[model samples]
Each structure stands twice: as structure tokens, then as C-alpha cells.
Target: MMNYKIFIWMLIVPFVINGQNKISGNHSTQNLTCSTCHSCDIPTKENPCIKVCPRESMIRIDQPVTDAPKIFVINKIRETDIYSPVKFSHLAHAEMSGLAGGCRTCHHYNPPGNVIGCSDCHESSRKRTDISKPDLKGAYHQQCMNCHRAWSGSTDCTVCHELKGKEKSQTSVVSNNKKRIHPEIKTPDKISFAAKTKQGKLVTFYHNEHINLFSLECSDCHSNESCIKCHSTNKTASTKTISEKIKHKKCSSCHNTESNCSSCHSNSEAGGFNHKSVTGFDLSKFHSKLDCARCHTSKSGFKGLNNECKTCHGTWTLENFKHKSTGLVLDETHSELDCENCHKELSYSKPVCEDCHDDKSYPNNLPGKRAK
Candidate 1:
């Protein structure tokens, strides 16, 4: 009877201790099981067994750069240390992050509400029992050093921290960084790459055309890009070791990088994308304002589309079709007529008036007045 009572107490004590570690605030209300955040069912303060930051599944809340403070004086770690608190330029980094992954690049475990700081999750004390995760000081260094090392190729202590005796006051540092902002990123219209391929030497990329004409966001092509790609001190030496697969990874999303090498790579510098010249379908007149996805619905490639108005418009007749929008307002006689009466060919470039009257032709004979 004594041994059985001792066994019951052992089970009850663990339950009581585990109950104390219950999540508070909005997280408590969430319908998440223990498995969502913790790997072990019985998580104690000493061994929480918390999973790594689930970036893919986490609900991230992103705010504009204007909403955040310009500079943050990082004095949380070791207040009595020799080095003064690092004055971090938040606005400048935020603006630069917009080109790639944005806030989620650093704030990996963000929830739905306001963006929380690193100290909220990462333990501040280095002497803490949670050996699995990095402390706040380690977390700060990890995030900053990763990018700085890539671009500058050095992680010297002086790069961020000034000596205690030489450093200015925190107030002065804040005042100086208050007005600091990242410079406007100048986009190139076109860039010509000299490739080592046997088929073609020059590969011209219309940089502005992809952004303005194709309506692609910067993140679409530039996701997961390191600072070294653009800001590397030795660009040639840094990129020389990169694999061919990594080089063509961005282009392979939209283009066939395997077989159609000549399409992008040519002996001479290639010109910008021309709808009329390449696809034989002139988009300059009617389809200039449309997005690329509007016509190219296929997930694969943009090859299957033929030059037919009805293929996209889907059987436009007298009732539903508006001829006035096409720059020609049809007359009473032409308005009553079917689309096939005027547009005999699938191309639908010009009206065929010869079908009704042999003497009549488009532009010369009036079907209707040109829309003002």
C-alpha cells in the first residue's frame, strides 16, 4: 500500500509541474496541440524540447518600414561589458530586406499580431539551461554576421562594436541614425552577360522590362538571395565557385533552361522581348495593358496559345460584344450583324467587308465612325 501511494504521487507531481508550464495569452486560446511547438509531450522549463522556428507554417505579420523605429540601441546583452551598445539602423536594413524576403528573413517565428523582437523567443541569458537554442546575444550576431560576412567577407568585432572608452553615448548614436535611410536602388534597363557556352556568347537580360512590362515582383526572382550577389567586394571571385545549377535556378522557373539554350544565349547581344517578332501575335495594340498570366493560363509554358480572339474571349456575339471598345463604333447595320460577318479570319486584324460587298473594304468604306 505504501509503494502504490508513492507511485501515484510520482505521476501527480509531473502533471502538476507540466500544468504550471501552460502557454499564456493568445497562444493559450489557439487550438494547437503540444506537438505543434514542442517535440516532447512533457516539456519542462529546463528541457522544453521546443522545435526550430517553423517559418513555413507560422503566421507572419509584416509591417511597413515607416511603422518601425529608425534605430535600435542594442544594450540588452551584458550592460557592464567593455563594448558600448550597438546602434542598429532598423529602417535601412528593412528597406534593403524589401528586395529579398522582407521581415520574415530574420523574424522566422512571427505570429499573426504585431512583430515581436528577438528577445521574446530567444533567451537573453547565455547561462540558461536551454542549450538547444541560441541566446539573444548569439541570435543577434548570427543574423547580422551572415549578411555582413557575405558582402564584406569579414566578421571583425570593430565592424559593429566600438570600444567602451572610444564609443559615443547612446543618445548621440540615436540622434545620428535617426535621419539615416537607405539610398534608392537604381534598376538597369538592360544587362548583357558574356557566357562561356559554345552556342552563344552574349546573353542580354532586359531588367526593366521584366519589372515594368512583365509585372514580376522583386521577391519572385530574388528570393533567398544573399547580399554577396550584389554587394560582394570581389564579385568575380565570389561567384566563380558557384555551381551552374545555382546560376540558372532563377530563370528556370519561367524559362526552359535545359534544351532551348539559344533562345536566351545568342552569338550577338539579344534584344528585348518582342511579342510580334517572337510569337507572331502583336500585343502592342489591344493586349498591351493585360498581364502575362491573363492569356498564359497554363502552369507550364506560354507556347500553347494560338492567335484567336474567340479562344480567350469565348464566343463573343452581337449582344455581349462591344465593338466601340475596339476603337470602332459599329453603325446600326453592322451592330446587328454577327462577329463572323466582319471578322472572317481568326487573327481579327481588320474587318472583311468584301464578304458582303465586293466594292467595299476596311478603313476605306465606313462600317462606323472611329471612336473619339
Candidate 2:
């Protein structure tokens, strides 16, 4: 009986082996073998499977990495030493980008993939992949300011950087609850914002007074968007020098030469002050050859017939009604000279007889004589 049983067990085990092998043979080579059949689709500790998955199913299984850090560099000078560090702000800026969609909106990557580490191209020292490596400071300012400029709103220096001597966090918005602790005190009404011009002229502009009296929309002088709309990035600006960037176009639109003058000259008592409460001057002939400020003096408030001739052609008496014919007085032969000759410096000043009269003597030939 034992011999019969062993023989039967040998035959049965062979049959089981053949059955398992048959099952394995029927499936694709990339899929399960007999021993692995049941565990086929599952990923495991020892043997992971990429085995015969659909594209979408692969994505579901592999799910690409998110929350990767976008990194760059910035160079800041501390105690006369410059540090170029690999600054990574994955958390804070990711929230902003998620709302804006994705990384390509602000950052550019080469040989693209879902990767975010800056080391793909930039070095640990914050150096670029190629010979044209941008320094860390240049990289940051270019990226940040370009995005900032593309966004629709006012762009001023204060928007990103603090004014020369202020803290970055100092300019942040304060909540009402936080304000209640100390309760910011209102500034006293008498406090003024007057300042002296580069030319040593005092200019006083009243902020509260204009708000209280004129009922002026803040946009009246400023653009519809805000104060910087006209003065800053949106407009085409040119200056005598970089320091003089506040071109008068910003102010002249609201208070042209006429209105700026009316601020004071409208109330002054001076003859031929036939100052039209005009919009601006329509310069013609000789007047066109004069400097804008020649008649628009700080003392003159920028208007009036400041045409006392002496205002421009100083001290030479117009043989009373002398220029009435040419409508400009040629008191001395100096007055008879070409308009551009004396005003050649291209700044507004009196057309002096001595400007061209090399032989002319001062206080005799011309009063208030200026050497050419």
C-alpha cells in the first residue's frame, strides 16, 4: 500500500507543475510567470513591476513628483562681502505659481521635464551651465522685475525695494487689529511737505488743502491707475540727466505753463501782466526761440506778458513803442541780433548786447550785462 501511494504522489506533483507552466506560457512574456501570477499588477518590496501597463495607468501608478523646489541665486552685499547663495523658495512662490498655473509662466528651463532643481543647469556656486553665466544678482533682478513689469499694475521702486534707508517689512500692510494696539496717531494738520528745488527755489505743495478744497480725484494729476502711472514706467521718459528724470510732462498735463503761472502771477501786481489765464503759450517767431522758463520764472509763477522786454532783453530801453513795428524792441544794436545768437547756451536768459558786442561796455552799453 505505501509503494502505491508514493507512485501516485509523484504523478500528481508532475501534473501540478505542468498545469502551472501551461498557465505561464499562455500570458505575454512581459507579464506574470506562474509563481508570480497572482501578484502581477502590484508593486512590491523586492520586485517592482512596469509590466504591460496602459499609458494612463502608468501615470496613475508612477504619479510625477510635485512640490519640487524652484531654485535660483541672489547676491547681496553684507559688510562689504558679497554672498552668492543658491536661494530656494519652493513653498512661498509655489502657492503663487499654482494660482498662476505652472513654472514656465515665470521660469524657463532647458531640455524640459517636470524637474525644478536649479542644479540641472546652474552650479552649486550659482554659476550658469555655460560661459555666459549670469551672476546671481543679475539673474534674480531680471527674473523678478520682468515678471513684475508684465503684471498689470503700477510699477514703482517702492513696489519691490524699500526706499534708500527703510526696512523691507516696514512697508508691508498692517492689519486693523494690529493697528488697534497702539492705534496709529493721525498726523497733525499743520505738518507740511515743502521742499527746496535743486535750483534753490522753494516749492510748497499742499496735500490736505487740495483734498479738502478742490474735491479733486487723486487721478486728476496722477493717471487713472495711480500716482506712478504717468511718472514711472508706463510713459516714455527722458531727462537732462538720469537724476532729472521727473520730466515736466507729468505736471504740465494738469497745470500747464498758464495754470502753473496763475498759481502766483494771477495775483501779482505788475504792468503788461496781461497774463491770460491761458492754457499754455503758443510761441511764434522770436518767442519760439526762448527757453520755456525764460518767461515762466519761479518768481513769475510761469506766466504773464512777462514781455516787459527786459524780462528777456534786459535793461535796454525800447525807444518807447520801438518794437511796436516788429512787435519786439531793438533798444540797442544787440537787441537787433538773431534770437539764437545770445540764447546759444540754450537756457533762458536775457538777449544781452554784450553777448555779441565783444566791444560793448557794461552798465553803459547794456545794464545787467552778461558776458557772452
Candidate 3:
């Protein structure tokens, strides 16, 4: 049946991809198409025919924890009322999930529109005939137990829920309930890795540059990380047995791993990413904070830019290019003067005044008036 669904989907792939000018709700920018989450060819507004398996649904979006509700009353299963509804601390759980997994920790199978709660998939009643998937009560307790049992080492139901009519136990002292987001992870400036390469043994990964400098979010790199990576006490990492090609899989997303062995690995420890060293363009002054995609502009990968102002901004004859954006607005005299008078180089990295005034050099001479 799955193969039949895929076969039918292939026929309408072109139309849904190009012909249909449709925008999915709350996920327009996501470019959510039929194939993104649906297995059926022509998914309608009434029925999307969403794939049950979350792994099969390729649209996994991890949203900020603050965006989620602070507290959710997991009282969907009211039939079995031996216990009161679980007052789930959503934000607290979200913050705790940060160390292990993001939203996927709970919302494992999110479609394009919104995250599907456990009640959506799991049946509310435990006495249901379908034993394939655990009922809602089973699903809820299982998810809660994974972490609660890990910490407490007991399956005590009171850890998450309180008995009926126990008003005092229903509400626990939660700290700053509204402000429930994961604390910003302190990124390391450099992380040295011992690579099993012939030439370069050490590779330094720049954790800080990727976040603050490159403007990469935590989710961009840590998409499907497991909780065991950090919290597991006895779980041994399986990286030792992995092949050389597989070793570079993590970095292959943005970097060229096959040919650039020496770029990352070396006899000594590798240094952090430097624009001057790699692209011959020093990003220290101006371009340090800009994302790599800003200048690269290519959706495929980051290639070197020409470094000339005209390369991106065409014919900057003084009126177009705003000097004020550079933190120092040019004065009338400096602005009026042709750029060639001061800047003689092909690139604007450094400007020289040798042509205009032999005695006056840049930084010493006031070619342009500093804007107040």
C-alpha cells in the first residue's frame, strides 16, 4: 500500500511542485508540498493522508520552547479517572529537553502544519482492540517514564500527577513559570577533535563561530541528536567503528570533506575558521557578524565572492552605496570626491590616498568627513 501511494504520488509530483500555487497554513515559508508530509498523490484540504510514521514525514520543524504553551492539561484520557489529569509543565519539560533533544523529543512525528499531540495518534482508551500502537495512557506514561524513571529510578505516578481531590498536590511550586525557555548554551570557541587521518590528526571545531559569528541556530546543527549522547551513563559511542567517509558526514553538510582533509586535519591542532586564511578576505572589521549565506547567495553551497564592491553592488557612484551603514557616514567633501581618489585598490578592505595627497595617508588624512 505504501509503494502504491508513492507510485501515484510520482505522477502528480510536477503539478504540486510547480503548477499548484498553494500555500500551506502556518507553513508557507516551509514550502510544504504534498510529498513533504503526505504519501498520497492529491492530498486535499479535507484529508491530507498524512504518513503515520514521523520518520517517513520529512517535515520535522523544531520550534522555540517559548512558542509552546506553558502548561498543558493532559486530561485527554478522562475515562480512566483513578488519577487526576496530569498538569504537564510544558515549558519545564521543554527546557529539560534541550539537553537531550529539542521539540522532537516529544513531538517525534510533526507534519507540516502543526505538531501532533500524543492524543492525536494514540487512542484515549486502554481497552481498545488495536494493540499495534500503545493507547494514550500507555503512550503518555511511557514518555513520562523514560525521563522520570531515569532520574527517580521509580515508576511512581505521583511524580507527574496527583491523586483526585488532592488540591495542594495538584500545584507544585514552579519557578518563573512564564519564562520557560532553555537557557542559552555557552558555545566553546574551539573544540579540538583527534581525527584518524594520515596527514592531520587534530581538527578544531569552532562552536562559537558557528553560533554567534555565523548566525547558525542550535537546531541547524543539532537536528536529530539523541538524549543518550549526553545523559547516558553506560552507553558507549559507536564512532570508533565508523568508516572514514562516514566520519565526515556531520561536516559534509556545509564543508567539502572528501578533498579538504588537510584543511581540517593536521599534525598539530587545527585552528578556528578564519576568512583571511580560507578565502583571503579578512572579515575582522565588517563581515565578521554576517551569515555566510549573505554574501555567498548560492543555495547550493558557499563559494568565494569576488571581494570587489561592484561584484555585488553594481556601479556605486556615491549616491547608491550608503556610507552611513559603515558606522561612519561620509561628509559632503569626502562623499563628493570620487572613490578612486582615496580607494586605489580593487577591494575596499584597505584605502590609500597616495594619488590625491602624497604626504597624507589613510587614517592620517581626513579624506571623508566623519558623520556626527
Candidate 4:
């Protein structure tokens, strides 16, 4: 009787395995053998050996929020539930993160691959054995509370979610999202810092121009900032006697804050950054939209680059140069002529036609017919 039963069981097991394989989905189609996350040969309800949290070296990679889902349905927490799934504003958080820490604010330990959700490392069950880290419920609240408390000064549960089925979670989500998110953070045009220094008392920071003209991201200048830094009601701050190096640490990365005291430090509130006035290079038309780092490649010291276009753009010759692209299509005769013939200085600034046509000059005379 035992021998006959064993033979029947062995025959039935193969068909069951075939049936499991028949189902096709992300989980079933995964290359992962059962052993990848489960140690048991045949995992079952009786004694399934499931892996712990963060089963392997977790992969994290930066992805634009545009690629990420705009809203995340966080309904993973199961047990005694008080509220419906929170309709998270994934895109709003991601867009706001650009000025803060980018996607790394929450996905800190993500390995370099697909972007994983918070539940990847944080187990959904709070009763699980992994006590080292917060469970999914705790992780979600923690991340949410950071900004929510800052935004409204309240951690009330209703602020983000609804009581199970009392209100339509979808309607509330749409209403909250449509109402207003973080108001447009107005960058200060000028920030007058009162410096306790003999060289100067006031240092005027050209806040908007740095963002508009220099093309600097808010994070580049204000990295590692917290909500308390801006939203704190207390206007007064504790005094700390910091060194000159410490005082200049943030600005030093882009400006020479050490010896060039006169440049920034003034008895009066100093003027904003002026390209032509300070560096003798007017960036009004050509380089107005460019970041400081574009031309000033050196991160340590923003040393000056040569005024010649060839300094950055390799040597330009008649064959490679496109005269028509300069808003002026060169005439047949001028097209064959060397650039230096008309552009005597060839500084790549306004060309001086007086070299050949002594009477003709740029803007007044046509190098070629006006590019229609």
C-alpha cells in the first residue's frame, strides 16, 4: 500500500510543477529560481523559508520623475486598518526633490538598477523579525511626516488620507493636488548678509541672477537644507564664531572668497555679479543662459578663460565655419574669403570689415546678404 502511494505522489508532483510554470507574469517569468529568495526546495504553507528584508545588495539608480509614476497607491499595509491607501503625489515630491536631494531623499540605499519602492527594503509586516529597520507602515509615515509637518505644522492622519471608506480617496487626492503644492519659491534678487568683518560689513548676494544668469540649481548652492532652515518662525539664530574658511566654504566652490575680499566684501551692500563689469566679458546675448560652470570649468576656482572663442571652441577655419548660422549668410565672394581677412582681430567678437573694405563695418555693412 505505501509503495503504491509513493509512486502516485511522484507522478502527481511533476504535473503540479508544470501547472505553476504555465502561469506567466512578472513573478513567474523572473529568472530567479526559488532558491534566490527561498532556501526551501519546495516552499509551502507548512514551512516556507522566505528571505529577510533587503534580500540582496539592493540596487538604486537615479531616474527622472517623468519616468516614475505620478501617484503611488500605498495600500500594502494589512491588518487592523484605519484608513484607505494614501494616494501619494509621487511627481510632486520628485519635482520638489530636484532642489533638495533629488530621488536619493527616500531611496538612499538603492543600488544601480531599477528604482525600487520603499516596501522593497521595508517589509510590509510590522510583526516581522527584521527589527533593524522600520516596516513599510513606519517608513511611509516617516517620509510623509517630514514634509507634511513642515508644510502644515500638523501630522494629523486625515491630512494625507481618509478614514477607510468615509471619503473618496481619489477625490481628496485630486482636490489636494489641484489646490496647491509648494508655492513657487521666490528666489531673492539680492540677499544682504551682514558680515562681522573689518574688510566689509555687508556682502550682497545676487540670488536671482545666480539662478537666472549663472544657471545654478538651488541644490548647487543650498544643499543639505531642511524645512526648519526656511520655515522656522524664530528669526534669531545662535551666534557661532566660525573661521574665514568656514564662512566662505559654500561660495568658495564657485567664487574666490579667500583673498579677493574687495570683490564681494564692501562697507556698503555690494552689487550683484556683473559679467562685463567684473570679468570684462559681456554675456548678455551669447552666454546669458549658460551656467558659470560651462565656461568656468574649474570647480575649485572660477579662473578666467581666454576671451578668444578658440580657447573653448577649437581653431576655426573657413571650411569648418558656418557663416550662414551666424544670422548672416555670407555672399559667394565673401564665403570663399578667409575669416581673418574681414575679422582683422578675429577675436570672434563683432568682425571688423575695415581690414579690406576700409569704409564697411559689421551691422552697418553686409558680410553677406542679411540671412532672410
What TM-score goes with each of the models?
Answer: 0.79, 0.22, 0.67, 0.64
What candidate 4 gets wrong by more than 4 Å, as runs, is 1-60, 233-247, 280-301, 307-372
Clashes of each: 0, 1, 2, 5
> Candidate 4 local accuracy as lDDT?
0.73
The order by descending TM-score is 1, 3, 4, 2
Clashing pairs for predicted structure model 1, backbone only = none
Put the candidates in lDDT order, highest first: 1, 4, 3, 2
- The regions of model 2 sitting more than 4 angstroms off are 1-92, 98-101, 110-114, 118-130, 152-158, 162-165, 168-372
Tens digit per residue, CA lDDT, model 3, 150-182:
555568877666677773432342443334444
Candidate with the greatest TM-score versus the true structure: 1
Off by over 4 Å in 1: 1-41, 51-67, 108-116, 153-159, 165-172, 239-241, 297-306, 370-372
Ranked by TM-score, the better of candidates 1 and 2 is 1
* Candidate 2, residue 148: lDDT: 58
- Cα deviation at 334, candidate 1, in Å, is 3.4
